[model samples]
Target: MNPNPVVAIAGATGAVGVEMIRCLEERNFPVKELKLLASARSAGKTMKFRGKDIVVEELTEASFKGVDIAFFSAGGGISRKFAQAVKEAGAVMIDNSSAYRMDPNVPLVIPEINPEAALHHNGIIANPNCSTIIAITPLWPIHKVNRVKRLVAATYQAASGAGAAAMEELEQATRAFLSGEPFEQKIIPHPYPFNVFSHNSNVDPETGYNEEELKMVKETKKIFGDDNIRVTATCVRVPVLRAHSEALDFECENPITPKEVRDILAKAPGVKIVDDVSANYFPMPKDASGKDDILVGRIRQDISDPSGRSIAMFVAGDQLLKGAALNAVQIGELLVR
Candidate 1:
């Protein structure tokens, strides 16, 4: 990696791609140059970075030329198509999609957790799923202190997880619902206004688990390097426009308490403790929107476990930031360092 790298963002006009540009600027990443690559339809558009307008270019195999680091936020197919080009260009690819997450050759990375794993990447690193990142950020610290044996997560995912269009659909649908006007749902599968449904990802008939839930389950084990960790999830799409929230319950190998969990998370990186009992405030999507840190709260014991080894908590994080772009950028930073 160059000391000051020429960074390229594939799918630069999308929600996560836009955030990737902002993260680089906000974090003051040493960028010798910036390249914004998107689809042909988005090409010729201008986006701002460092008070300058950079025109978005159509992504091609040749887009990786002279690019030291490439942040890929496009869909899996795009990432797969251009991956070889990126590697052959002598640039590192930090991918946000699930294209190569479970690949043994690609390291699944969360900077706050297994950063060292990123160093072993084979020219590509994979960011974990948004819900997995939100849940596991706080859980990693606790797992370090008392090994987590099992995890059960129920994710309240925002429309933003689908993309910028889905977010706009959410807002537009809400207005249409309030005005008693007919609205057609295009981006999101279900009627998103004032309603909740299972995650938009296709469900597996045999296992009864959606792709989103399966990603959380598999990615958590890979990132933690603990296949023995039992994981299950029920993912749902909520009406929020941004930020994802999760209700997490986990059983540890040893006994753990709320105070211990709080203390552990308070000192953990990329985590913000928001557990307030008297005021009855906990992590919320509204509060977590646009935040870099994952807000965690509602810590308590899961009484269902007779052994008193289970704990429950709530967490929220910006899906486009830490869950996607920021995490990919953080991996790039690790490479540079």
Candidate 2:
């Protein structure tokens, strides 16, 4: 690889797309040439990178030519359509869509838990679902120490996970509620202000859980290299704009305590512990947003269960950064070296 490798950012104007750009710059990724590609609607718009205003180009087969790495956040449809083409263009793709996540050949990486897996990319590596990535960031380190057995989790995801339009819808609905005006809804199936809805979209006729929930259960086991780890989940969409939170009730193979969990997480890379029960210092959406580290708090032992064998905690991370943008950038960083 060259000292400054060329990189392309597909869907460079969307919510996660914009965050990808910032993350690459923040991390000081060596960018000899930065190409921002989007759909025809977004082409011709300009984005500044490395002190120059780079024009957003319409994505085509040629978009990835001469590109060293491509960070994709467009959508599953776009990824399914052009991901292979990007690879054929001789660039490695770090895709943020679910299209290739379950592919046996593609590595669904969190960087914190499985940096080694990033080396096995077959041109396109998948970023795990946002909720699963954050939960595993704190849990994987512990799982390595005390093997996770049966797991149950519920996610409190934010509107930003759905993209910028959903965030705007939440804001509009909240303002409309306060002003005694009619609430409008379109981006999401349900109204967004001060409300919660099942995050599952288009129910799976057999399981009843939404595709997102199913992804969490399956991806967790796959990423951890444990098909035998029993898991179940309930994913819910919350009105928050940025961070995605998860409440995990996991029973491990060994007895685990709050202090031991804190000790392990405090030293894990990309994990920030905030578990102080006396002052009620815990991780929150506002506190986690715009940050790179996953925050874990509300640490306590789950009673009615065997001591040192079970623990319950809350984890939060920026869905746009570590969840999507930062993860993809880190993949590129690892790929270059």
TM per candidate: 0.99, 0.97
* Residue range 1-337, candidate 2, lDDT tens digits: 4558899999899999999889888899988899999999999999988678999999998888899888889899999899878878888888999999999999988777787898888888999889888888888888999998978899999998889988888899999988989986889888778789999377798988889988888999888989988888899999999899999999999899988998998899999988777898898989999999999998888885966688999989999998889988988888776
Against the true structure, candidate 1 has what lDDT? 0.93
Per-residue lDDT for 54-163 in model 1, tens only?
99999999999999999999999999999999999999999998999999999999999999999998899998999999999899999998999999999999988999
Instruction: Judge candidate 1 at residue 64 and give its lDDT.
Output: 92
* Whole-model lDDT per candidate: 0.93, 0.88
Give the number of colliding residue pairs in candidate 1: 0
Q: Report residue 186 deviation for candidate 2 (angstroms).
A: 1.3
Q: Which residue runs of candidate 2 sit more than 4 Å off their true CA positions? A: 1-3
